[model samples]
Target: MAEWRDPQWEYFAIQSLRGKSFGDEWPTIPEFFQYTVERFPDNSAFTTFAGEQRESISYRELAQYVEALARSLQNLGLTAGDRVAVSGKNSPYWGIVYLAVLCAGCVVVPLDARQNGEFHKHLAEFTEAKAVFMDGDLLAKLEEAETEQPAYRKYLIQSRKDFADATGAKWETMWQMIESRKGDTTGALSSLAQIRSDDMAALLTTSGTTGNEKLAMLSHANFTSNLIQCVYPGLQEILSTDRLYLLLPMHHCYPMTAVFLEGISHGSELIFPRGLAVQQILQDLKDGKVTVFMGVPMLFNKIIQGVLNKVKAQPAAKQLMFRLMMGISGVSDRMGKAIGSKLFSGVLKAMGFDHIRILICGAGVLMPEVGEKYRRLGLNFIQGYGLTEAAPIVTLNPAGTSEVRSVGRLLPMITGRLESSPELSAPVVSVRGHEVGELCIDGPNKMSGYYKNPQATAEAFTEDGFLRTGDMGYFDRNGYFYITGRSKNVIVTAGGKNIYPEEIEELFQLCSWFEQVMVRGYREDGTEKTELVVYPKLSEDCVARIAADRDAFLSGDTVKDPAKQEEIIGVQLHREILADVQRISRKLPDYQRIGRVRVILLSLEMTTTQKIKRFLAESRFAQHNDGLLTESQDF
Candidate 1:
């Protein structure tokens, strides 16, 4: 129906080059590296921008560094099956070390650099990691946390200064380890023949949203299979020359497999930002000419809100025209014709998405409306579902041929089933003649098991052997999978009605007043009510206005008492926010509508991965409610 929409998208995993290329289908990740090296030897593999200076390395250069690092580890007593941990921000060095460890036949443990020393020590002890590579400061903290260290431990410090000779000759660790040993590739070569596809390549911890932390052992075959799945037709159509902006933490599976590995396998250049500061991100986007953007829902929510809020605040005629255009664009999309891309081309360019062709959202539920907003803006926005155990990508919306509401079609060779259960926090909702249930999946991309945790691993699978996703979802008649919410996060009302907080939470996001919102069911006496814990950042203008009102009230004889003046301003602020909440609540069923609004000064606590820690939110809200600055409720 549209020029951008392609009706014919063949499933690629089934037809992947596993058996065709190099005579073996299940090749190790290191082998995948070798394949890319052979084809694009001098192509830009990695790049980092610092201030006005830019430094990068080619595929061949990356391979030599990986070989030297492998040899150095071998010299340091690293051997096959020996565990080694890597905790650092995303960098070419992080990528180099990960490949080198696998090339040396050791298991690579990807740790969160944002994690504290105690967590690192626990993971190191659990994996029995004999060596580690981490940022300099984190390294010292981890060492302090682990007292019984052996003498011959390997700790390769991952520094922030570029090692591209631009940082100077004497401070060049890359030159000392790699450039000096450029001629000799003898040591790491032999070990490559010994490693198998099924061998454990990486040991990564879960996001722990489902509960306690557990290590997921992903094999080389598992990741390699997922890489092929990503490149196959109907998925992200990334080119070899595309400069992918690598901003997310590399330790996470979303970036580790999807962007870093997948992009590299396709010969794409990986662009690292100067830093996470907003200016740095914007500069990298403009300078790097980034084509593919990957991020979570929170990031996109801010962008959508910023753009729409500006549009709404414009002159009355401009606001009306913009809204009308968006309405037409959204309508065009529903009919399978995305005229939005053409209609909103000017708006997209003005918003700095000029070079962005594909945008992927994951790690949390992306409300369908958010997806629709971007799609109507002419952006190829998509949402997917997966966890650390599934190599982080089981289903992704294929560009051009996509259902923005559903996550995407299941990747080729991946099978999924829904198991109905009533014991979950809320009753499941049926959609389009399909009943929702716990979505279980079985695939080659699945993890072997949780490392050293047999009990958790045993309970992770169904009797027939599908991995319990801990998520509830359903599938449309056309085979697109739709995620409802985390089964545990669903809230059951007193009327026995199922309310997916995520669904209700999305409705709240439609309002521009709140920065973050969490929907939860709390009981009072004999019944329960759904409440919204909102965190709003006041604008400079709002703060100034409040201050002016307070001073004016205090000076006036009509409000002579100092305490009474403060109360009047406080009441005014609460009523304004509550009025907006009440306006939005009408879209929901009376039972599902928010019964109370609790405004907090602080943000809702979130994990390092940017996921809301639901249990923590419940406990903290129950205990303190301090900074419970304002509230409006209907008891």
Candidate 2:
């Protein structure tokens, strides 16, 4: 075939690798890593902050470690295309094992570190993983289980001597494996030549809590193409000097591809925070001089709220000055100049966000107000939209030209269209000049298919080969995309109008008291109407305010009876939150207005990725009676 040049793949760093390690197609993950090592041998690759000290590794040193581990894995009977699962917290060791699995020509399955042993066992058995590298605590859990364990070989991610001394089990550790094979020449590097860009590099499960987990098979081309699409043509700019922060779990594709792989491909230093603690993150941000930070919407909201709460505590004159500076910053940013950082230099330094150059949000929706606030603070805040099925990055809002209302512009070489018909399982209708429909994408970034599930794979794509994203959305006139909600969460009213729960849920974000909220269809007088289930933040002040509102009911008998006090608070909270919802829903069409509300004292269950598990919440609502509102209490 004649050499094909894709403008997207022509990113200078990728272009430098062409005709060498990479061909006309994208390079395998290992190949790209090697290219980076060769280009920036002395550059710091990975660093982990551990309390008072930090551990760092250079690109060359990381490559050496990866190759040694790869040789050891090959010697341990794992060959090309074999499955190996790695489960651990975010650390340099986890990164080494992940790269080593690919270097050994095996498919790396990065398991969620937060999942229990049973879930790990299910995943191992499903993927037929021949070997597993896991944290010591997780390995112990797997062994202590009374049920039969999977027959795969296990290697501890901890020290061999420590784990053996603690558990009296003689399992080799990753470091031991590497030490035993040090300086021993193996054909692992030679065999890596056989790996192609189309080969599967990673097998990621989209849904694992359910027994029917859909494993998305992503090829080398899928991820590398995504990296190219995101880095070039003004999507996101990253340089070798940039230090990327890794706070989220590495098993999730968002952090894996966006921060880890993208950082390595550009020879940028990746800082692994000690933990997700707010103080620890702030310290790491300041100490590591992190330039790029990526997180979920919940984390961003909490940070922004923290900043605002502190600002509100300042004297009236200082608060007014802050507001004036913010207005000036917003005006300057809109006119192609940004002076917010310079104006709020001291404030940024105090908040630990002084060194941050770019803030990216993914894996959930970010309120427009949050994005605007960050930009007003002279920070580059942008969000992208993607799922595990699409190698996880479909569109990224370019910095400086960001649109707060839209997710982002579609990446180069990626084609997207909306389908509104019987073919699409969801009902999509025209709304506000843009036809709301299922967003289908076609590009190199799309996954190969669901592994081992031919029927599910067949249903995931359209006849012309666009991956059906299962997200109902529309594109604005300026080529920006807006996602309303998931197709499965759509609510149909008696009037035959479609209401997306996500659209309704977004309205609740402005309510600071709501820690979490979910919108769903409920039966009201034999008609389906929208109902909101809110888990409010019971802060000291919030509780005092609630008590003040129900002063008449909380006297004598009610005050003495705990159950009665609880009941009164729940009822009054329902009314207050419902009133706010009514005020907000008035802007929407009549059919979409919320007709009922439920206030639950307990917080809603959240996934490891910080997403509300709607189905799980519904299951709990059906099974439990604590604080759950009955259908008879409809407004």
Per-prediction TM-score, please? 0.87, 0.90
Per-residue lDDT tens digits of candidate 2, residues 390-469?
A: 88899899877646768897887789998764433334467787888889999998998998899999989999899998
- Highest lDDT: which candidate? 2
Model 1 C-alpha lDDT per residue in residues 1-635, reported as the tens digit of each score: 13223333222332365554332456787777877787788889999876778888998878887888787677667788898888888888888888888888899998988888888888887788887777667777876776785432545445334444244332224335555555777523424537778889999888865457788999988998887766556677777878788888888899888889988777889998788765467678877878888888877877788788789789999999988999998888878888887887787666667788899988887777888889888788988778889997988887875477788878777888998765454445665567888889998899988998989999889888898888878888878888877777777777777777787777666666676788878786667778887766566765565456543422244334434433643665555667777877776778788877666544566755577778777766566553332334441
Off by over 4 Å in 1: 1-24, 148-154, 159-176, 186-193, 334-337, 425-429, 538-573, 627-635
Error of 2 at 477 (Å): 1.9
Top TM-score hit? 2
Candidate 1, pairs of clashing residues: 18-25
User: lDDT of all predictions, in order shown?
Assistant: 0.75, 0.79
Q: How many collisions per candidate?
A: 1, 0
